[model samples]
Target: MYTPKDFVESRLPVLHDAIRANAFGTLVTAGEGGIEATHVPFVLARDEGPMGTLYAHVARGNDHVARHAGEVLSMFTGPHAYISPNGYPGKATHHREVPTWNYIAVHAYGTAETFTDPDRLLDLLSRLTEQSEHDTGQAQPWKLSDAPADYVAPMLRGIVGIRIPIARIEGKWKLGQNRPAADREGSARLLEQCPGDNEQAIAEAMRSV
Candidate 1:
């Protein structure tokens, strides 16, 4: 999160968009056992608080579930790619540019709490499922109700619901904004020709910036 002034993104809507687009995130917390991190998919409630609220879950047996009531950090990573100096227009003239990375990331800080109520957990699961299914663009998206209630009940009981009302948030879009306009444009164009999805995504993000 060491963001330079040119790369800092504080807009609430922009931060929220990044979180929604990259829903899978790492949740970090410090406890007696030191720092622990869990990777999970999160659901954002944009209007739930001043910043927003995050919803996710961990297995009931997970140590994280036992140490949930505290300040925590959730990190969402978006598209990223290696920026080769060869792509820089200035490289040919000055040979001063070095390789760097371009990426989008958001960090959310909040106090986390756990819930065990069956109804609330069920609602959380439904929302998570609905969002994921929508992203898959399936004609028949699956729902929690599609499964037998008895089977789903046992599954829900095996996990704990987590809710974090965001206290603060930070977004960093390291999309070569610090470079000269010509260099930035040149790098983005080169990235678009790359084969990977991440390279293409970084290129698009750079152009939009």
Candidate 2:
């Protein structure tokens, strides 16, 4: 991540929030077959380690897990939107403004390992289901126990679990931090009026900053 000084976000709490909010991340690994990437939802354990840990899974048929070694990179992307030059107050004065993009992103680096134990796999599945269901406000969340053991057992056998103990994390929130105060305010106002959810989110972030 090539983040400028003004856009860098190093606070662990902020990084954790971004990871939790955008749990679906791209997992990248380099091996003999070159680089392979997989998009998957992750479960972040904020207090599990000095730098935290991430949990996810891959299909048994996906051979990427078998080749995963050393350090892996997990990228989480948050709200992003286009900012037009028209939104900058200085555009009218000097015509120096240009269109840009604002976004929030987090990159986590860590050692990745795979687990195939049935017990651990079942526990991982259960935790994933619970967290997803809770997020959706389901009154009666679905459970692995809802299905017959024979059916669930076979299904669980089809995937491999992954764990990454984060060694380092970096976050970038490019929310007009480099822009002048007046220009940032103008951009936020224009973005807030836009109908896109991402634009509105950027507007809110700008205002908060």
Which residue pairs in candidate 2 collide?
none
TM-scores of all predicted structures: 0.97, 0.96
Model 1: which residue pairs collide?
none
lDDT of 2 by residue, 84-117 (tens): 9999988888998779999999999999889999
User: What TM-score does structure 1 among the candidates reach?
Assistant: 0.97
Listed per candidate, the RMSD to the true structure in angstroms reads 1.0, 1.2
Local distance difference test values of all predictions, in order: 0.93, 0.91
Q: Model 1: how far is 203 from its true place, Å?
A: 0.4
Candidate 1 lDDT over 1-209, as tens digits, reads 79999999999999999999999999999888788899999999999999999999989998585665578999999999999999988789999989999999999999888898999999999999999999999999999899999999999889999999999999999998888888788999999899999999999899888
**Global lDDT of model 2:** 0.91
Tell me, by TM-score, which candidate is best.
1
